[model samples]
Target: MVSLTSPAEAERRPYGPRHRWVVLAVGVGAQGSFAAMFSGIPVTGITMRADYHLSTGALGLVLSCLGLGVAASDIVWGLLTDRYGDRRVLLTGLTATGALLALMAAAVTPGDGAGVVLLAICLAIAGALGGSVNGASGRAIMTWFAEGERGLAMSIRQTAIPAGGAVGVALLPWLAQASGFRAVYAVPAALCLAAAAATWRWLHEPAPAATATASATASATASTTATASAGATAGAKEAAPDATAGASPDIRQKSPLRRWDVWRLALAGGLLTVPQFAVLSFTAIFLHDVKGEGAALASVTVLIAQIGGGAARIWTGRRTDRGGDRRTYLRGIGALAGIVMAAAAVLTDAPTPLTVAALALGGLLANSWHGVAYTEIAAMSGPARAGTALGLLGTALFAVGFLTPLLIPVVIAHASWTAVWAIAAAACLLAIPLAPAAIRAR
Candidate 1:
């Protein structure tokens, strides 16, 4: 039997020099795969709506259906990652996702409500399988990276979302026009398969120190020190590597989901991401319907938003590392997100450049918090239960991911697009006042 590292053992063995980076790279690529496939409907919303004769609200339901599936499956995937490790979970998920995407391509029929429903079901399955990527990839990164670099590392991993969104927004329209929406699905499927192969070859669990090595290390314990100390997202953990370095052989029972701090972070995170998802879901439609931009051009603005969001993630991620109050930083960003989203929503009738500016800033600020949030979870929970905590957080956050698209259209129909964005802005601002535990969990 291939003995995997217990969580304690994972703590003892320092991550390999180059292997960690390779893991991060492969993991980010897989992240892109997840984002691309789930966001496919919205990215190609224009063509899909026309083909299927979907009303705005109906389209929202179809797009959000996939995220609903992701929300449902997120925790399950997290648990699997904790038990089976990131490699097995991610590889299996991505590979299955590829096959599902192909089935979606072959199965969906244009202009049929039943066809849309069928496509939605396929997407939901694909989303669930793809949901495997987030928590597992995060746990792997937490295990391999020390504290000093974790924010930046997680930031890069987080980029997979916006980066993939950008690719879908920029390319999928052309692909849809050229070959049909089926071709668009084919791209993600191919990418998933390729990512699966890369993951198999490159990803490895942090090796557990054998008994002999542990014994030897005890004698020379003073000679080594970790750059990152032990901690949890909301829980206050001491910085002693020796304290829990040889934890129980089974670490699955130490779940972080029960902690209030974890739940707080999860809830706040879910709410804060609403505007970002809203923008991603509606920008193409809004611009096409309101801004008079063609499909490709309208997509250009959202594509730029993704680019800006990625850059902001990298910047803020690096900044979040030198932290006095990670939770406060999160809070501040949440408030800022609300302000920007509301402004962007109202910018519909403003000058084109100004409208684009609001969207860009909204994208940058609204979506940039993942690295910081994930870092806090890993720091607080340690590698032992990071998967579960991250997974729990993902479940909460993506629930909004599932709902925002579905709800946005209702607001648009009852009020206006401005009202839709204003509501998203309020969601972020509302999260600000309910303070979670600070950098150190009590």
Candidate 2:
């Protein structure tokens, strides 16, 4: 039950607790930029349709290619981050993502079939490279922040997704409108390259401190058994396996996928993400196509939704850090999401001001639990295996990203947008019960 702090922990840590703001800043930038680029395809769907004369189904395929690329390669990236360290993996991945995005921009040519295929290939490749940020930056922040404060830190870090979505909403539309689709891609590409440079300068590898990982339930079970001893109760209570779990190699030597807790958390995270993906990838299209809003109005609506979600993420993370059952918090979030989305589905009309408010609320509640869920995942696995764990989780999540759009159209074809949204709501509600199982297993 005894724990030892690494002497080089300070040196290996990317930032001390006081300087932890640095990790927060870098995490947001790296994640935000990657989120922007990765989610930009759907955001730019209208522009691409005009530029390439493509259909909705075709656009879905293009976006699916990118998601497929991320899902297929996330495990590799996660392993690399754990093996080579966050800083190196993040820098390399971010640099390559920017460069590949630029190449995709160049490959674009209006009305050229071959060029469309080429662009999809480039986007797929870029997505594979961009995925490194998830595992790397996630591990970095987890390494820097302690568990008591990590909820806020990770929530702030997770805000990058919506923050990046907001960035994409703001920049991609304006650039596409002003210059061309090419300019839209170039902007995020430039931001990513610059972010990589900043990351190189600021972030450090927490290799020494990183030895504290793998939150095994066996150790906690041992602690609980010892809790009966009066003198050892406090020590027993404090003894989570995170203090004793070995480094990345030790983690890698074991099978992450074999861990039932990891599988539970991963599945929960993946299922919870369906609603978020619906918000991120379909908001603009839904508003434009179903609500009869103009492109500008649709874009702004989606942008507002993303901004709201981002703010909610930070606030939710901070409160969760203070104390309480995080799984309960996530369950509440999922329930709220279900109610909101189901109401929207039944209303069948988005013309009123109230509909806008509901949409925004839906977006906020749909996305808010992300940070809390991540905190649970990190606690279950610790920093050493977080990347690999996240990778396994991300594959399930992004596969939804790839398939959801394609499936939405099919539902709309057979039923209505109401059906599609109701399906998303169902996914959210299902996540509620999944959380308790994940928690119990942990």
On TM-score, the candidate that comes out on top is 1
Residue 326 lDDT in candidate 2: 67
* Whole-model lDDT, model 2: 0.70
Cα lDDT computed for each candidate against the true fold: 0.74, 0.70
Alpha carbon lDDT at 151, candidate 2: 69
What is the C-alpha lDDT profile of model 2 across 1-442, one tens digit per residue? 1112233653654543344567668888999998887766577777776677777767767777777778778878888877777777888888988998787667654522445677778777877888888878888877766654666788888889888977787778667767777787788899899889878777764443332331232334344545545433433333243421233445534667777756776777777777667766666667778776656765676677777887888887766544445666778888888898888677657564566566667767776777877776665676677778767777777777777766776777788877877888898888777765412211
Clashes of each: 9, 0
Sum up the clashes in candidate 2: 0
For 396-416, candidate 1 gives per-residue lDDT tens digits of 888998899888887777888
What root-mean-square deviation over C-alphas does model 1 reach? 5.6
The C-alpha local distance difference test score for the whole of candidate 1 amounts to 0.74
